[model samples]
Target chain A: MEATLGIEGGATKTTWVVLDAEGRVQATGRIGPGNVSLLREEELRALLAAIRTETGGQFHSIGAAFAGCHLAAQRERIAGLLRVFWPSAKRVVVAEDAHSAFAGAFGSGEGIVVIAGTGSNVRGYREGRWARAGGWGHILGDPGSAYDLAHIALQRVYDAFDATEGLVPLGESFLERTGQKDLEELFVYIHSDPSKDRIAALAPCVLESAAAGDRFAVDVVLSRCGLLADQVKCVAEKLRFDRPKVALVGGLFEHSEAYALLFEEQVRSRLAVSTVFVSRVPGAVGAARLADEAAEEHPGVEPKPSRILLRESATSLDGALTEERNPRSRFLDRKSVPELVELFLAEERLVEEALRERKEEIAAADRKSSYAVFCLKKK
Target chain B: MEATLGIEGGATKTTWVVLDAEGRVQATGRIGPGNVSLLREEELRALLAAIRTETGGQFHSIGAAFAGCHLAAQRERIAGLLRVFWPSAKRVVVAEDAHSAFAGAFGSGEGIVVIAGTGSNVRGYREGRWARAGGWGHILGDPGSAYDLAHIALQRVYDAFDATEGLVPLGESFLERTGQKDLEELFVYIHSDPSKDRIAALAPCVLESAAAGDRFAVDVVLSRCGLLADQVKCVAEKLRFDRPKVALVGGLFEHSEAYALLFEEQVRSRLAVSTVFVSRVPGAVGAARLADEAAEEHPGVEPKPSRILLRESATSLDGALTEERNPRSRFLDRKSVPELVELFLAEERLVEEALRERKEEIAAADRKSSYAVFCLKKK
Candidate 1:
């Protein structure tokens, strides 16, 4: 019997599932962030090979969604690597993980999926169209995300401190959670080696504080949720979703039932959002479905241009020039060829910095890959 | 004529003025941050020797205000270094640089000084008593500071981005100012090696954007100034100064005439402020006056306990374990002897981290000190 494999890579961990032709889960495997953008070509190859070994079976179809796989060129490159890893696979597809998230949220149905986990993004599908808001990242976007909640809360604490309202309950809770003795140590704990997931890890404290009537924390969460509601509204308006069904997916919503309810109330008030539900479908399952669809498609259809979606872990792209589009994408439409080339060159300069920042993760992955790759190649 | 020297050390640089007994400036010299807390014992001694060499003359009195000299023990340690540098000086005193700023702002008179530079503080004096608000540092306090302005502006930009308000004029200006091409690059520009002064440097962009009529930027500055106004009132109420004089000191006020005007408008509307003026008296000059006063004081009059004032650059204290008092100070009066010792030991672990961070500055000073100390010894 023919089978299909689907992979979903994230900042914290990478997971994949194998499905028999009948669409039943045949096997599952997990590993570190075998991510798209940060890995060198060889490392990526090693990761894919290891995945195949874990499945311990041949596949005729594959769909892989990795963070940092933004452009058609990137997707095609990943597809080529998969072909080499699983030579028997006749159909292969690779896309940015956001697609998998959307697939996970609503499958083939039309609705908006708000992914506000380690990073954040909002993507909607309706009538064969996709619209999105706030998938940019923590730096200039992703407001109302877990990172935003924690960051704004810190700002409020600092601002409150100026009014001689020093170290309110919210700030004190953060100090306790992080095992930070004082504000100075907390600052070091954050800025010294800031990570998106790591900072977002502190969001639960803000939620806990707000739940317990910490005024500042409440304000922080409410304001962020308001922004997030606006984000949903933007996608709703853009996609013209009449009474849109929304899936509030991420660690944040899962961490606190009160937080999820608060966010739902906000979005419901701001947007006539019809349905709000925490996502139950795993992104890897959506990838498997996508794999199934790809295998069944007629060979004549030109591969559709993958729509832009946010990576699972935007922090993986920190210091990384996250080039979403190549010269062909809409982002480069206004630029002259030379200007576009120059833009790419400027991004190239920052690539090494990103690689260096991710060196530890790469080294750790390399250690795991060595044994895994050797075993897979022998098979 | 008897001679006296005054030294004021900030995060960016240190300056000293040798004053004649009549309070005329005889000579002035400047160098890099001869900070207190970050410096090791030998490094502090070396820095003092360098200052003495630059003075090129013997002094009867010396008074120094250095960032990080918070505790009585730290002040005494600095005084001992100064004594070694100026062996013939009859009187030596040391204090935190905030005192120098307060002395600079009001001299011997009683008034409130609002310092909203890279970091911030509000200190008011009345009848030999001092009251302070908001000198805590950027992590927990120092709102209305330059760093706060820049940071808050960025947060607004991020929140706005969720609603498709990405890279507003204020954020664009920050990118232009930092020479970053995009938001992700700007994040790297900030978090890669976050520093208080470095982040504070972005404040002018927000100020400029506000001047240019960017609504968010305008709100950021206005709100921050309003906070600064409240801070002034806190100090004023605490010290019970009737229609007290307020000095708007620091780079924020110095950077823009309109900003200072806006701040004054807020404070005047909130409090029955008698006078608000930009400070012209440099902290070094205030330190010079303090030196002269020390030289003239009777031997029986104990050197007064140094009052807490905000540092000239609070960034120097970032990531540092800033201990403000030893067992003797009023701060520790309520604590048991055992608790005080335990607290000091807890701080010892952080001391090494601070030292590691300041190693480059120490090395830079050591090179300069070797030549300077040799010349001074020969004299």
Candidate 2:
């Protein structure tokens, strides 16, 4: 019996399932916080070991969907890790979450898949090419994301309170909730840590309260939905797929009635998109199918790892460290200017400048001093 | 019978309840993210109405924990809002969360409270006076917060991955979770959003994986714990709190099993006169009680707010908004010389000279400019 494997990895959790060739889930194991970037080799190995032990059955092939696993080096390292454990398994493949999400949404053909979870991103697949929009994290990007909508609402409400504008029920509710004696405390709280996404998560409750007839809460919700619609417009523009069958995947779209209604209404009103998919499909399922495709095409060919290997790979999947340059690990190695810039920027001086606007002035001054003589006379 | 209210309001969520004065939670209702700074007046009024509906009983006197209520202006606004709602409530008072947490811990006495939730702050209170350490945002501070821990882990793992150091399991796991494909992808993800607290939340998982023998994860966790301990020690040293019982509050310390243990062990090992108290007392309870204390002590006294209402507060919360100030708003406000210097220093032009490595060359250029000015004056 060929053992089957299923993997569900997300920002919050990672789950793996072993299935027989017939597709019955034979064994399943779960691990905490499975984003590989956040895990160490020992932890990864331990998690992998847990799965390997639970499944026991040696599988003929392995398919994995990694959260944030779009890089080639990451795929190679993951493949090497799987190769160690399933030595007999001829094929191991990894692909972007978007690919898997696309597959899960349309199965085989072309369509647009929008993922809105803790973060947000939209991917369009046409003519075997993929174009992505948004998902730029909760900061600079993530336009129509839950975090974005919630952040905008919160900011507007806060602005109203600061202005001492007329009474808003949600603002009053906010005062009651924070238990802050006044505006000063609220500002401090907002200034403190400031998780816009976490704040955004509470958006659903606001919408619910509004639908139940709280004018203030409703206003906030409407404002939030409008902001989300604006973000969707940006993505639609980028992908150039107007009126495409858009599948909505994320807790916000799935749960919030007010937001969903408002979002759909706004999209129809604002953009000339043909179809809006309200279908629920997991990104993980999409990721799994993408892996299956990669495996079929590549067969036994595992790309060389670029420069980084997972901790899990060290112990179970990839096995012993090679003092010499291992052919398999080479694919994980590549250098980029931006990557180098990031390193240089890590120095305290650069980090300080990045953190504070004024610090850049100081850095510029120091630069001028060093180059003053050089400018006067060629170096 | 007087109504009793249970309110839990922070930067994240808000809750309000009413019970008889005998202290039984009666009716309960929750509204969406209610930070006053983020709400409009309409939203505030609507949300407050919902709370009133949930109570179903008249609140003779109510209590709440509010976020960013530390400012005098904010306090007056909240008082005004509350007055509008429960007109005949015998009394109302507001105070800071530090005071609330202190009261919750000692109930009117003095102790140390270390909070490590979305942000990290340590406050030492003794006989009404308070001292604080490290509650800056992810941009500046939050040394021991979950965000801080996660940020440090990301940095370390990335450094290790890039370095020629022997690969570890934690490194591998990190790669698996991030799916960076390679260094370039990893760089992009790190630069995206790059929240310190979200990163800190991932520490526990690293700790868990490390304990199971993920060496890389273990190293990261140990280093993070060390940083946290250092933060506690820095505050302890600054304010000579001899054998003070440091009450640990916040999700990071409360939820992470080994993290608390490791933190406590590290602190004890380093400080000769320090005791760590893992308390169950919630900050909200403390905040409510603090409000009661403030009400009792102040009697009928209420602050007369400055004239600078919301219209004049159009800039960022850090007091950058000067464009909207009217004569009335600017009436009593005066900037100190030091404050002016600080503001001036914030200008991008002034700080550039200091950025260069050769300060003397810049100084020479300045001297030449001064000489030219002299010559111009002579002419």
- How many Å off is the CA of A221 in candidate 2? 4.7
lDDT of 2 at A273: 59
Give the TM-score of each candidate. 0.66, 0.43
Candidate 1, residue B32: CA error in Å?
3.6
Question: How much DockQ does model 2 earn?
Answer: 0.06
For candidate 2, give the lDDT of residue A247: 55
The 10 consecutive residues of candidate 1 chain B with the worst lDDT sum are B315-324
- Per-residue C-alpha lDDT of model 2 across residues A209-286, encoded as one tens digit per residue: 554656566565555455445555554555566466555656665555344554555555677755554433333333
The prediction achieving the highest DockQ against the true structure is 1
Summarize candidate 1's per-residue lDDT along B1-379 as a digit string, tens digits: 4777888887778888776665555666777777665566787777777887788658887777876555565676667667667778777767666667766665566788888788888888788787777666665467788888887787677656545646687778888888988765665466544677787888888877665656677688878878878888888887778899777777787556446656766787788966666663466756654554543332222233222211212212121111111222333335542343233223444545554665555334323333432332233
Global lDDT of each model?
0.64, 0.50
Best by lDDT: 1
